[model samples]
Target: MSADGGPVARHSPARAAVRENDTVRSSLEPAGAPEPIGSMLARNAARFGEKAAVRHRSGEGWSELTWARLALDAARLARFMEDAGLRAGERAAVISRNRAEMIVTELAVMGLGAVYVPIFAGYGTEEIGRLLEHAAPRVLFAGGPEELEKVPLDRRPEVVVDYSGRASGGAVPFAEALARAAFSDPGDAEVRRFLERAAAVDPFEPCLMMYTSGTTGRQKGVLLTHDNMLSQQRALSMLWDVSENDRFLSYLPWHHSFGGIFEKTTALYNGALLTLDDSLGKDFDRLLENWKEVKPTVYFSVPKVYQQLYDHVVTHPEQEREVFHEELRFVFTAAAPLPESISRFFADRKIPVLEGWGLTETSPCCTITDMAESRSIPGVVGYPIPGVAIRIAEDGEILVRGPNVMRGYFRDEEATRKALPGDGWFHTGDLGEFYGKALKLVSRKDRVFKLLNAEKVVPTLLENKLAGMNPYIRHVIVVGSGQDFLAALIFPNYYLIRERFGDDIERAEREVRESLRKTIEAFNAEHPVKYERIRAFAVVSRELTVDDEELTPSLKVRVKNVLDRNEPVIDAIYDPSSDCDCRFLRKVFRLVPDSRKCFLGKDKTLDQCHTCGRVVFAEGAPGVGEGSVG
Candidate 1:
């Protein structure tokens, strides 16, 4: 198809001579090779018109839109927004879950000079209001009526278009809006106008306004240009063996840059199939059921997803191998720190999990393991990708500079100054060291704390190591900043523990503590360091949820929040006397033989410390592999 979405014309000699190799991109045929993403979309539509460009699960089954079809649909959508008075430099808010329309709307919005702000599906009215106040978008494309209702009537955009057909309350239905604006034929003047408008767009202009997940504080908007996104895709295409035929089973929330820039836009740029996990929600069971049908070549998942899948593999280990071994081209992980256990699990099966690292302000990917070029390193997220430079500060903080870096945080100059320094480097806050040529990611630079004994503790590294060894440990937070010894507040998967020790909380707690001790001991056995060891632990009964501000939307534990929330329990653990009557952490006094009559009474043994048997806390226990905790 041509730019007008009509019959294609034979390519000119110059166009035909453009590099078609996987490594040599078309834009790079002339030296400085970055182009607008809209141009890339046009190229894909022309090259592979009838090929499946996008897909989503439908009532009948999987439904796909051809490259030609998407190009036409995008044009119509752009025209509709234009007709509704959306102009260049204005903003449009996309309040939807991961869907084909969301991608289409983004591309359409980009083609116009308008930026599109992605609102993650689960945001509450207050959160939505907070975002709306910042962006003040002229148009809002809601996934459903429920999504549309989150915005106050006064806060509603000038034009409200509902993607899902099952929406009401004064919103324009998606199909009707497009039909009203669309021209019947390519020969129509309006069609020509739409094409001209798209072609006139400046690649360097701001095209994206992505909001952070706000784990630390208020969510800030990160503005990115078309060049920034297009540069990343082009740079990535050179490293990975990405072809026009590669298909992806995408489940990553599209609101984040990792999903939007890497998965969705990558598929569109390469003319590959992006099979949406239309499980209605990000239901793992439903996702697995859909997996049998899609059988994607490339898979991108967070660490938790792999942990859940590993749970299934524990019962049916070989089944997962048989399914993914031959079919999967590459399995990648990001968003949160990936446990080494999952990497080793896949590695043992000769299918490695490639890890990548980045922040939202950097188009979410500064470094990625090139599956074709480099060997997999379990914990290290590989070398920096092309066009990106990495430097380590004196404090071990990773600093990055690249075309993919955002222009700045939208309307937040203070944040922009602190994050993206005037020196042109963005402070990643993540600590990393070079392992030969590859980068080995350590814990956050700020999260590292010194114990009262003057020993340094990287909490996340210790947490990941412990979590890796145990199956029942859901989450662990190492707490010992300016304290004598390290202690952990553990959150176990209570359902599984309850199944093993039915209705017996005391027995279950004891067994879990014993099991956790064994696991952490195994980890310490591998390392000879005494200061890195965790001395004691207290298991929490309740689960952590984003609702309770325990976990971020990406499901990362907010350590400060956790620490602040459990300050009393943490203080109680470090108390000098064993007589404290704290609810969360209590002391079990070591009774003498005479006192045993009151403590253990007739059940007291000669060898065992009878009072210790009743205690939930593992107090001042020496490190089994090294030395004492204090």
Candidate 2:
């Protein structure tokens, strides 16, 4: 495996030309010319032939699809798409999870000069409708009935193919569609014609539309050109040293840029073997079961998965953590800010969890911590990619300008113009600061709030601080606008709560709430009035997930949804005496000689409050204490 755990493939012409032109300082590419996406697949097929290109978990066992088979299947699908009247430049939508068939569909769509539009599998009917209206795909591929249900039977595309047999609404089976085209003669002439047209495509012509994970408003379809994808892929390939021998186990949704440009295109460009695992939450056991069998060289996952792995390793310390470390040469954490604690946990085991920063607009990877480099800063997102330029604005927003930047938001010129400035710098809504050579993301611009006292506070920072207080606290969203104090909506980890109180929902909830109250009091005692204080809060019974519409694809909190759902609780926080269920509130009183002297449990009088039974210090009396109200 290469240093970054990708394949050890030869250099493409693009890398060669870039190196010859002295665009990149690294000499990581092999001696060969660059090929377009389709041509690159053909080259890999010719060279690797029978090598496993993809492995998928089936009912009986894991099935392998060789490079030659993948190419042939893709070619058959491409011909079928053509026969179904999918015209050049029209879009082909894949509404599915991470699966082997999804990969083939993408290749087939690109081979026929059609733009690929991947809708997230977790999207609801309304969300899917917005994308379908914008992309207007001629062919739609659904994973199963749940995904197909989002598309009205009469409103679906002309050609609808279902990979899983769960769909019985007259949709064509994926295998049957491929078989129909497989019997016909290979359309080399037609394939070449499409390739020629694709080659003629300009660097700025739209090739894909990836919808942004809508956290604030309606999702915007990001229009990414061939150059956008290729540019990011080339930069990443060189940085990570990707090659044909690398094996990647993909569990992230292919609809997102993380899966599309990074996992899919990067794997294809470098001739890497990509094993598809659509079962994210459901099939994680299957993944752990197959980890030794698959032995993926490079792995990319969100912070939550790593947290789970860390928890598992900690719980079973007798089992060697180094085994997991040795299996992966490079592991990347994206889609959310990885906690310093988690980073340290992996570091202790000699496993580096390199945190990266990017968005859908930049084809998802702009900054990555180098695996070879030992400079692992806790919160910084490391240096920018080879061809990418990063600039910190006066107001702390990070601006990026590179070939990887999207062409624009599809058919939304106003938003495109607003997001991508005239100076070529795309204003990332994320606020960041340059800490040495690396950039530390502070918070999103939208997430920054101005209090009624006119003090600006970044909620993410506070949220992070709160999350670090307890493991059971899955996520916390701070809300304070035109209010005297900040309040939070907490989502407790259901599994942890269940484990703590087996088969007793009410008792589990009460224990979780009391634990959260104690954490809040602890936080209040540690910091000052502005940052450390969360006056009131409520505990949510269930943890937020992508399916619940409370988290983005990257697993960040959906602030708007949380606020909408807990408006009543928020209103009750400000009106403390209101007939609200403020039963979770608790007081931790430390009666010191002076309030200023009390600093994170510094010198204090110790007595219990009569009313609340909270530890308190009396002002003058020795045994009796002034009650601290909740």
Best candidate (score: lDDT): 1
Q: lDDT scores for all predictions?
A: 0.70, 0.69
**Which stretches of model 1 miss by more than 4 angstroms?**
1-32, 184-196, 280-282, 370-379, 493-511, 524-528, 575-630
Tens-digit lDDT string for candidate 2 (1-630): 564544433332223222212122223322233334576666677788788888887776878888777777777887788899886678889888778887788777776667889888778888788678777889889999888988865568778889886688788899888888634333355444444544454445677888988789888989887777777776765555767777787777777777667776767777778877645644545656556567777787877777666665665566544437465666778877666677777676666567778999998877776554445554577667656767777888888877778888988999998898698799889888766555677999988887788877788878877887787777878888776567777777665555457799667655765677678778878876644377656554456777778888767678898687666456444542233322332222222223233312223444433333444333433321222223
240 Cα displacement, candidate 1 (Å): 1.2
State the local distance difference test value for candidate 1: 0.70
Give model 1's TM-score versus the native structure.
Answer: 0.83
Candidate 1 C-alpha lDDT tens digits along 66-159 = 8777667778888888889998889999888888888778878888878989987677888888898889999998999889888877788778
Pairs clashing within candidate 1: none
